[model samples]
Target: MVLCHDEIDAVNDMQNLVAAPSLRVTTVQQSSHTTLLLCSAYNFYPQQIQMTWLQNGEEVTSDVISTDVLSDGNIYYQIHSYLEHKPKPGEQISCMVEHVSLSEPLVQVWDPHPPRPLTERVKIAVGTFFLVVGLTALVVGIIKNKKRTAALCTVMHENLVAAPSLRVTTVQQSSHTTLLLCSAYNFYPQQIQMTWLQNGEEVTSDVISTDVLSDGNMYYQIHSYLEHKPKPGEQISCMVEHVSLSEPLVQVWVYFHCFDTGGVLLRVNIGALYLQSKVYRIGQLYMISKHSHEQSERGEGVEVVQNEPFEDPEHGEGQFTEKRIYLNNKLPSWARAVVPRIFYVTEKAWNYYPYTITEYTCSFLPKFSIHIETKYEDNKGTNDHIFGSEPREEETEVCVVDIAYDEVPERHYKESEDLRHFKSKKTERGLLPEGWMDTQDPIMCSYKLVTVKFEVWGLQTRVEQFVHKVIRDVLLLGHRQAFAWIDEWIDMTMEEVREYERATQEATNQKIGSFPPAISITETALPINVRNGPNSAPSTPLSTEAPDFLSVPKERPRKKSAPETLTLPDPGRRDSIFKLPSFFSWNSSPQPE
Candidate 1:
């Protein structure tokens, strides 16, 4: 039975309701002149709290900064308050807190807690616990369906704490020799074994094993090395054994041997759906290795030109920003001739791409300022009223093919309304006072996924835009189809791509359903057809040159270049295979032994 609010609060009061926030005051030596005191209160519940500072028993106000109450969603909140002062000898400083459930504000005098322990000393337990849990669940459910439960348990074990995932990295050391390197991490239960296996048998000699390394998260991983020049048609594998699995985990690496195809350059345009309420700004481009798991990736955050000044969008309309980035190492000149470029204009969120959100890459919020003052129209005469100056030719991005725009409605409950409604129930029970309610705000959540599909040369390119905030947006994270298309684009030619794109374009047209193509094309000079406004050219891609086919290059190659962005597979520096949520497993099952 559900307990009444008064009954729950009464029970909570007897149990002290929530833990009083524990306070720690630490000092950071900013310089020879002043020291900064950090006041942190954590492990508290029912977040309504007031923390204050005092210098020598008098309430201190200036130079004080406190974080907003941050909730862990279990009715618990963690917060920090900071103060900066010149440490005058014999001046006592302290931090005080008042909670709804506390009788007296617990005062903690200034005592510096020891510096946070370095990560190297912490021992973490990895997949071992979850694997055992799954095994237990499998046993408990065995009577219901033994085969299916065991299979599910095995899959869980593989996903939770599979043996150290082995990544085989090979670079052509020379025309005659290659550096065959195998790196593994994201594992658990430290007693892991790694070895090089050729064909099917283990190769003991000519192998190097490093001591197990700690990520300090309780997970241990180590790298095993083998340096050798290979014979043709030979199969190599990095096999690992750990306690998480029913059997050893093996990752077989077939050499990208005797390359018949030219080296490829991949360009990705990076932007987030959350940036819709802004002026049209250019996106970032990065030079990444097209081959999966290549080391040495770097971001080149080059800003492309902006378009004509526009006004705020009308209701039910959205603003779309197009960013084109190149993904590949510098290619041989011949590779440029047949560069298999991929363009996706679907409205997927930023978190979907693995390589996009890494620490070494640009992960946090979008770059441009939050400015929304643009309204675009197609008639040439309308520009004088919108822009103080005439629009420049360089700012225009000519889509030399058919264009189509569609709106996908993403329906979600208005979150603020949900939260407010929840708070009102508590307020009625005298939990939170009536002052927290704002009766004026209108509740809304109906949003549209703005999409634009067009062809660039023969590539079926689409651009999708939808606004999102953190937690709600994270639920929409998806990338399989997009990345797969990215991979497939590596093997395509312009003419062949166009043929395939024609089919997909036709399919999309069918889905538009009774709506005439939002875009129309005609063979005319300098005439722009923009049913939607605020469109412009993309910034120059880092690696691939414009094909000189459909679209014109946005800019000439810059003389000065941003240094190369490298991909670090070092476990200490990456999320690796464990980037998935705790229980989600990738379909990376090892081949049967």
Candidate 2:
């Protein structure tokens, strides 16, 4: 039978197989003295299956135990083995069963009571204690971490530590707007502010917007719209103000474009001012501008006038075109004063007008005279009233008037032939005379008419006229010396012309002599004449003459043996008609004596 229960109370439980000779047992609810066991006995094919208890080698069987064959086709036999009294320490109590198929019976025995409850209770207690300690430590650790985080936040707030960094994000330019996206970092849980400053002044409104994060950090996106072009020197600064930092952090960026001035940009030297495109004297700054009247006016008005006309209106910027002048070390005060102003055209172009004045002293001339005489004779001279006088005394007198002129002589007149004669005469005389006498001679009185002319030059007319009349009367007196003075002036001028020509010729010759000749020394040294002939070999001497040794006479005659000596006629004793052979004859041999 199957048994179902919520719980089982047992010290031990045993079940035995009838045909298979196996047994299973369970022990429960037995604290002492009770044991559950199984036993089996085996004989032959018809082996008897039975259980028996042995106590002290004696079999004890009880009726309270039940035995049967299991449904699994195994032989089982069971019998409870109990000691009538508690089992003695040395006694053996066992359950034994016999099976028909085995030679011996199987037996199992155990004490039903055990101390397992005390061991299990101790294990459960230890596990529960460890679990409680682990949970408590985890809770304490979590609380400490929370406190530390709170302290760190407090310290960071006190120190005002904020992360300051900048990065240029997206830059967008639309039709009229410029947008910038930026993120800012600062210590959280505090009040911090950001602002934009344009050239040191705060800009609060008209900037786009700001966004704050859950952690008290902020993201700012700004759009700045421009309605007009920005002026030069205008600047924009991103100014951030926060409680986390002591001072506001400002980043400023300036915008400007290069400009060209349409003026002479001079390379300025040391100790000089570059004005009007030229380096000018420091002292002459005013005078350089003064040369241009328009520039002078502009310089005077520049200080007083707030809005001045642009020097070059077309170019928008006030560009002054420059001019250069090389300065002299020494300059007059007026020139120095005016140079600086006139050096450049401040208003307009400068007009330069130079004025000059000259003085001349009057020269005085002394008195001078000229005289002229005319002689006319006719065949009826005694009856002519024009020459009324005795026949021999009859004469015609003509006084030639001398025009006296005083003033500067005309330029053409001074360059004319007459002035050349006058100047030449003055050089010869060294000085003008106080007065002069003129005379004219009457010739050919038989039938001739003679006329004489005289002229007197002077610085003043009255003196010259008085002198002329005197000269006229002198000439009318038939004086012959007046013509000589006139001829001297003419001759002196001709000599001057000749001298000038000669000097010119001498100068030309000197210039010519200074130059080297065209013919060079190297060319002159070269041989002009070249010989043309077949190259001849040097001549050899003729052998027709005697050997040189024989040509020379010896001082002494050669010695000879006494027997070989031959007597010869002495030239001194021989007759005059016979000629002796020379001592150095060609056929002669030395005599042996």
Candidate 3:
């Protein structure tokens, strides 16, 4: 530990030195004719510094761009200066940095010269060898295995899957309709197929499929949508057929509910019959009706719903979709390899947009990460009156609720400009909330209570943006089959808590490191020593008995009782046996007396 401490201190001291500017000259692949010289100085303390690029001992100010001084989070600063040049043989490039902490200015140089003859010879020889081998292998391969390659291509054409992952998400724009989306991603070849089935029968009409999109890294994704009134026990599935799969991948979802109440209103309760081992966000489920199990079991015909334009004087819920900027996943892979990644890297960049999007069901997406909850609700004060039929004159009010630790957010939510991050709070009695005082379903009596959980790990602070984006993602991602995956709900995991703490600590350290040092250091504690008073007995003798605790119970006294006498029998015989038991002899003698 001591050694580690010393090493850390030594590192800090060394990093505090005036950094020596280093230069790297390299060719730009984008501009084949020009070379770029990069000069960097890092880990220098005392913020004021001077940096300049030099060409042949003369300052080269043109075609040079230098970055603003940036702190490396310890009061030390770093800067990168770039110079683009068309270099000739024997040309030189250098950078100079001047700082008050330095005894002298530091200069670093990069010499650009053509490769040595030996190196040129090695490159030519390797190229020639590879060319000869390639020609020979090409001729042999063509002559020997053309037929085999053709057969494999045929097989692959029939079974290859472009996408490896799938997910479905749903959002309710209104209590009347739920949008279901089917997403497939992490692809190889783009040859793919998709279909939707209701109660095992393929629904042809009202189903829309998207053109396959490429991430440019050889992966592809596509979406499919189905608009219809849901029935219970209705086995809704998105069947994807890919060349790499021998059998089509079929993901089934059933959202069914029944009525068990005999009250004034027919209270409908939703039953989930989805058997697939998949996870769905808890928020999107709110916008759905309980599947009519009896209706589906009896092979009832489902009502086909069409995609009505929300802005068409018809609905306000669909207006949220206008702000959605979709999956722009066409980015290059970090790996120089050919295999595509499971999750799209470009997806994170898409999130930087002002709008938030929900993946109603991107079938293969590992998780749904949105910052909103979606649900169908019985219109509370207005009548149409009070439910999913007609919109009232009032502008649609959408509530973005926080599901505190995956629970309903009826309480402890901060609302600013219509955004909310649900926080867990103690009850009036100061205990963890166990009942539904505030946690009750927002759309209670409307149907099922649905909340869409977002992957809002770092978004708690951005209330307005978080809330708006959440509402947008839900509208865009929700389709007919999007809400099929059963959610695996849990609170904060130990690993997650630890990771959060670790990140917070790092951020705090970085912030603290960038500040100026303390001008006046305070002592850790007051340093005053006192001599003990003369060791002597007290003036009065100390009481020996221990103090009694008023609240503690005292031992009860035992009740005294007389001991009972036991009579023995007399000897059955004078010499061999007792005449009677002692009790009989004692009683008989007493009677005689």
231-337 in candidate 3: lDDT tens per residue? Answer: 53355677888876788887654342222111011122111212111111221221111111111111111111111112112211121110111121321242213
The global C-alpha lDDT for each of the candidates, from Candidate 1 onward, is 0.36, 0.27, 0.35
- Write down the lDDT that model 3 would get: 0.35
Better model by lDDT, 1 or 2? Answer: 1
Looking at model 3, residue 116 earns an lDDT score of 54
Tens digits of per-residue lDDT for model 2, 171-269: 212112222323354334335455666677876544432233223122222222211223444655566666556787654432212111111011101
The candidate scoring highest on lDDT is 1
Using TM-score as the measure, what is the rank order of every candidate, best first?
A: 1, 3, 2
Structural similarity to truth (TM-score) of each candidate: 0.25, 0.16, 0.24
Name the runs in model 2 displaced over 4 angstroms.
Answer: 1-160, 167-170, 186-190, 214-231, 256-593
User: Which number leads on TM-score?
Assistant: 1
lDDT of 1 by residue, 322-404 (tens): 22122223333443344443211111111111111111111111111111112222221112223233333222211100000
Q: How much is 341 displaced in model 1, in angstroms?
A: 38
Clashes of each: 24, 66, 68
Q: Candidate 3: lDDT of 360?
A: 26
Off by over 4 Å in 3: 1-163, 256-465, 468-593
Ten-residue stretch with the least lDDT total in model 1: 398-407
